[model samples]
Target: MLNYIWSAIVLLSVVCSIFLGKGENLSAAIVDSGAQTVQLLLTLAGVITLWSGIMKIAEESGLTAIFAKIFSPLLRPLFPNLDKESDAFGSITMNITANLLGLGNTATPLGLKAMHELNELNGSSDTASDEMIVFVVMNTASLQLLPTMLGSLRQTYGSNAPFEILVPVWLSSACALSVALMIAVGLNKRKRRL
Candidate 1:
């Protein structure tokens, strides 16, 4: 569906240029766009490679374990039923860390593992547990402390200050995560009362 939409957009642009008597200019733009695309991809590749390597180092050096320990107290309230020593706890910590860095690609596998662990804790129940719901909301909210992906995109597109949006991103993400948590908690309380 998206491929069709993109194709239509490209075709429309070319047709419109011809109708506007800008067909000759369109040829130059098309050539320029290809070069720009290559440059952008190269820039993005370097940034992604650096982040991936950093994540691997953090994992190997037990930095994530230390982080998990530090964040466990907060996790207790958010996931009351999760066993501290369980695989779910570890997977959840790693997933959150990945999200915090805005590394969605790295987060995906960790999120999947966390879901698997959550299912295990649910005692094979068909429905999701409260903790699982919270986890999903948190993932969706995605409160990024360091939005590397966005920064990289900005840099690729030739922004002068790529990471200047960090504060705004944090502010918005915090608000979103807070709202989601409130709604999830309210629903859970109402469910329990029923």
Candidate 2:
């Protein structure tokens, strides 16, 4: 579907350029944009790689374990079915820690593992469990401490201070998490009542 959409968009753009007598400009734009995209990706890859190594070091140093310990209490209520020291809990902790540091690329695999573990806890049900929904919400609205991806984008784009949005990002993510938690709890309770 996305492929079709992008193809349609490119076809439209080519048609428009031809009718507008700007085919040459469009040709130049395509090459230039493609090069720029590659350059930006390379820079972003460097930033992501650096952060991934840092996260690995943190994991080796038991830093993620510390985060798991801290988050365990909060997770208990949200995921009552899960054992306190379950593998799911460990994955969740590692995933959230990576997210907090803003290494989204690093967090993806952890999150997938966490979800798989969570589904096992759900007994492989067809429908998503409330805990699964809550976990998804938490991951999606993940509060970032570092905003590494955004900072990297800003840096690549030549921003003077890439990480200046740290405070705002934190506040927004906190608010999102709070609201999502409230909604998830409310909906779960409502489902129970019905």
Candidate 3:
């Protein structure tokens, strides 16, 4: 469905360009778009590689473990279903830590592993459990102390103050996460009562 929508959009743009006698401009834009995409992919690859290497080093040196311990109190309530010493909890902690550092590309695999472990603990079923729903909600609204991706983009665009948006980002993310968690919890309770 999304593919079809994109195709339609491209077709409409071409038709509009032809009618406006701007076909050459459209062609130039298309070429520029492809070039920009390639550049973005290369940039993302470099960033992901650097962050993943750092994460691996941290894990091997027990830095991740120490951070996990530090953040355990906050994570405990969010994942009450998982045992404290379980691999699921560890993965979730690492994923959260990566997100907090704004290393989203590095966090993706950890998040998937955590979800897989969570599913296994839910009796290896195909269906998502209540805890899974809550986890998804929380992950979606996970807070970030650094906006790494945004900062990188800003730097690429020659921004004078890439980190200037930090405070607003923190405030917005906190409010959004709180509201999302509250709504998810409320709905879960309602479901249980019914």
Quick one: best lDDT, which candidate?
2
TM-score of candidate 1 against the unseen true structure: 0.77
Model 2 lDDT tens row, 39-157 = 98898888878877877787788787787789988888898878767878888888888888888888887888889988998898898888889888889888899898888899878
The C-alpha lDDT values of all candidates are: 0.86, 0.87, 0.85
Candidate 1, residue 146: Cα displacement in angstroms equals 1.7
Higher-lDDT candidate of 1 and 2: 2
Q: Please provide, for model 3 over 66-107, each residue's C-alpha lDDT reduced to its tens digit, 9 standing for 90 to 100.
A: 877888898777666668777777777888888888777888
Candidates in order, TM-scores: namely: 0.77, 0.90, 0.93
Query: Arrange candidates by TM-score, highest first: which order?
Result: 3, 2, 1
Task: Return the clash pairs for model 3, or none.
Answer: none
Measured by TM-score, the strongest candidate is 3
- lDDT, candidate 2, residue 176? 91
Model 2 clashing residue pairs (backbone): none
Displacement of residue 1 (Cα, Å) in model 1 is: 9.2
The runs of at least 3 residues in candidate 3 whose Cα sits more than 4 Å from the true structure, single-residue gaps closed, are none
